[model samples]
Target: MQAHFDAQQRQRSKLTELGLGLSIDIVAALATSAVVAPFVAIIDRSIISNASGRMPLMAGLQDGFRTLATRPAVLARQPSVVAVFSVYAITYITANASETIALSANADPLLPKFLASSTVNIAACVYKDKLLTHWCSLGPARPFPMASYGLFGLRDSLTVAASFSLPPLLSTMLQSNTSMSKTSCDSISQLALPCMVQFISTPIHLLGLDIYNNPSATAVRRAQVVRRDFIPSTLARMGRILPAFGFGGLVNNKTRTTLKRWIL
Candidate 1:
């Protein structure tokens, strides 16, 4: 009778977890969208150009605000919500401020984008990945090298959200009938909002890129640019991200084992 009762409880737990995870995502997105709409709405190129300078900082500010608004999802993982949010909020705003300032100054557009990738990566890997990893979950033990950070921001920016989103998904697939380790489950649950937002924002990011860099370009031209660029670029990014995230389960297992052995 005890065994039978336990089985019923396990079944209910799975259902509850799945339901709660979905709810968290919906709430986080709804909250974040309101925060994002305002910044992205106004605050285009400052008329003074170089006088105002580095205007893309607002994009970074947008990124920071968006990340902060999504804090509800990360509540379980972050040790101190205020500290983590403040760090990432500052990092993102600072980096993007530089990008926008450079753009307004008519500096080469590519340079700011390239340089900002490194810092953005640190924000994602450290703030997003490291901070959120529980006391003994399978997050990487040390900082990835500078080059790796570059690759992370430059190439995998969108997919980090995807990557972070997948482990629990994999966990769910593997043992949907049973409860998962709390640490593992919570981490994945937290990622749901970020993953959905990243995938959904693919087009928006691309559109912003077209308009911001080529200010003189007409709306039709920007639309044409978006059409011409979106497919090939997005596919290329997903192509890189899919394989990496797809292998996430194996990577998690190995890392967890390594950490366990070290602790012993």
Candidate 2:
């Protein structure tokens, strides 16, 4: 009778944990999205504008907010703006919810965190990129190529690893070597890795955008676009990535942790 009672208690505990976790995820997602979405939305527009050859990098950066300051109503109507907030909310909810489940199951949370964040980020980003590419086009919408998704997936996966998986490991190493607090280490690792990973992911991102934007262009022309855009696009991407993954990830995780401690 005692053993059976203990088993029942354990099952009840798991259910309670799950409920609490989902509540925390909702709160964290909202909190992070409220803070991060505006910056991400602007930087995202800049990257896409620069990639699509709509404008030069510096001009694109300025133009993102220029529309907002000058024409708030028009900026409010843009689909990409809505997509940015939605993606951030969805990503944080999935990331923390999966981690919560892994904890309840007595499993390593890192793998679930990595998998959930990576899959959701890649899908959300590819769809957003496709939408923005068409939005920026002077011509009518063309069919999106499958190859674009494949390339974007590869790039986003590397970024997901840098954002979710590698940060904890990097923080651990940093903490071991230095006397900084865990928060400091976590912040540094979160910010630094995403910026560094852009070097590798930027070219792939530009190539994927080129292919999607001008699917009929020759290989030589595609290569030339990639080469020409490489430096500015890479720099623009690094700026965008810092807000999206670096500060965003850190803020989301910290909010989840703080909320869990306070309420759960």
TM-score of each: 0.32, 0.91
The superposed Cα distance between candidate 1 and the true structure at residue 120, in angstroms, equals 6.6
- Per-residue alpha-carbon lDDT of candidate 2 for residues 169-245, written as tens digits (9 for 90 to 100): 99999999999999899999999999999899988988888887787899999999989988887777787778788
- Model 1 compared with the native: what TM-score? 0.32
Off by over 4 Å in 2: 67-77
Clashes of each: 9, 0
Worst 10 residues of 2 by lDDT: 34-43
Clashing residue pairs, backbone N/CA/C < 3 A, model 1: 53-101, 54-100, 54-101, 54-102, 55-100, 55-101, 56-100, 57-96, 57-97
lDDT of each: 0.41, 0.84
lDDT of 2 at 114: 94
